[model samples]
Target: MLAIVSVTSPIFLLIALGFAAVRAGWIPREGALAMGRYALSFALPALLFNTLSQRPLDQIIVPAFLFAYVGGSLIAYALGLTAAAVARRTHPLDNAFFGMGVSMSNSGYLGYALISQILGAEALIAVAMSILTEVLLILPLTLILAELHDRRGRHGLARTLGKVVFQVVRNPIMLAIAAGLLFAALGWRLPALLGRTVDMLAGSAAAVALFAIGGTLAGQRLQHGLGPALAIAAGKLLIHPAAVLLMLFLVPAFDPTLTQAALILSGLPMVTIFPLLAQRYGLGELCASALLITTLLSFFTLNLGLWILGS
Candidate 1:
């Protein structure tokens, strides 16, 4: 519909602009990386903190929505891992990375930008909740699986688990979420000046993050690994959303907006760090190709998803 386009077009345009800028050499590769780092470390954390801190404790946690979203993601992850294990039958680490490609959603950058614009600031609670689930549960699980596959029992299970826990706690996004939730629970409010400063940083997150995503895509090689990449893309763009829909149906009562938000977020491409994580396991080529393919394909798929929801 025109209304949907009106809401989504600018967000895509910003992404396109970033893509073009990078492709045309308007922004150097290093600059794009720096921009992405800034968004991830500062802008996004500030935005999450601002949004979560101001919200009531109850609003920050939605059991039904979290259950549906996390359940769907786990199902998709399991399916992808099974398919990869069966098809390759040699590299368990690769299978774990493949599963990651299928399961992780680019919620922080693409999903947040789109949902905030389309659904407004109040809808951010859903986005935050999804991000929390990703940071806390899905990401660590996949990383541990991949690490275990790589180590092959050489490393002690306790040590591996401890390392993953440390990494998660040290993550700025997770720390920000924890801080925000604590403030909300304690009924603390930011001073007027500090609140305005946080808002200023948060306001820049969407555009910069999208632009960085575009640039990141521009930097990836998209020709190789087409076969497996396409399969992973299908899992991300189609199967993930379908899983979310199924879980939503299973949940007896849920916030309709949160349900819709979960679907949209599920339909997004894998998180921007997919390739970086894959690089550690030497699966970068496949994951990068899949990320690019899914991200480019998501415009049409997301539009279709929105249409389906509207109808």
Candidate 2:
């Protein structure tokens, strides 16, 4: 347990520093937001492209691992949707967001930071696979459902689907993943200067991303929607990882390291954008509150998960 904490504590410490910087007014809220944007838009994408392109395509593409992760996610999503529909607390329009909150792990930022620390470069294969699954499949499905169920949208279904496609098409992270795979397939390498630049950017990703997340968390408030937030957090921090673990048993086996990566990543809190998306459905505050609680609680859950997996 102490060994696990030794590995995980520094990551949380960075997160805590970000929160402190923002809360103490050392960094303005806008600055924190910009930090997040920088990490997401620049650092992370660069890191993904560099890590992925340098690896062999055979090692990068593991269909069984992808299936297990996605299968686990869908199970959690179904549970969230079922809870939203059956529970008295959640609003009906919140079904999509609720489903999303439980399923969408914070893979881009938090997951990468921790997994890379624990598993080193090998974690990238699982990270890339999970990120691709989240962005390409789960996210689109959630948006489609949100648009279909959300009565406030003036756009037609076709237009909404088209918009979703364009958004995915232009996503920097998605582009990075695609470009990385292409490079790997062709056995291409960047020039020395360019490679150095990518390495520099990649090096900054984990720390900056972790700090940005903490800063973002500092800004969230749980003023209302306490009931729903707790429920969502519980489902996200508890059920999601369990579902993923179960799928690991049912699906075709892969490398144990990749298996551990999948389990750990699945245990992460929901993505930071969860609340922003739920805002369209008038559940922004609820999701934000849920996110805050989930992230806070994940510290212990993550520790326990790592200890268990290691044990």
Estimate TM-scores for all models.
0.97, 0.97
What is the Cα-based lDDT of residue 94 in candidate 1? 78
Q: Provide backbone clash counts, one per model.
A: 0, 0
Native-to-model Cα distance after best TM-score fit, residue 169 in candidate 1, in Å: 0.2
* Candidate 2 C-alpha lDDT tens digits along 1-311: 99999999999999899999999999987888899889988899999998789998998999889889999999999999888888765444678788888889999899888888899887778888899989998799888888777767555789889989999999989999999999999999999999999899988999999898888888889966688889889888888888999999998878999999999988999998887777777777888899999988999999998998888
**lDDT, candidates in the order shown:** 0.88, 0.88
Q: In candidate 2, which residue ranges exceed 4 Å CA deviation? A: 89-92
Q: Which residue window of length 10 is worst by lDDT in model 2? A: 87-96
lDDT for each residue of candidate 1 in 1-311, tens digit (9 for 90 to 100): 77887888888888889889989999997788889999999999999998899988998899989899999999998889899889867488878877778888999999899888777888898888889878888889888887787844545678879999999999988988999999999999889999898899899999999999988888899756588999999999988889888999988787777778999999999999999888887778888899999988998888888888988
Name the lDDT value of residue 263 in candidate 1.
93
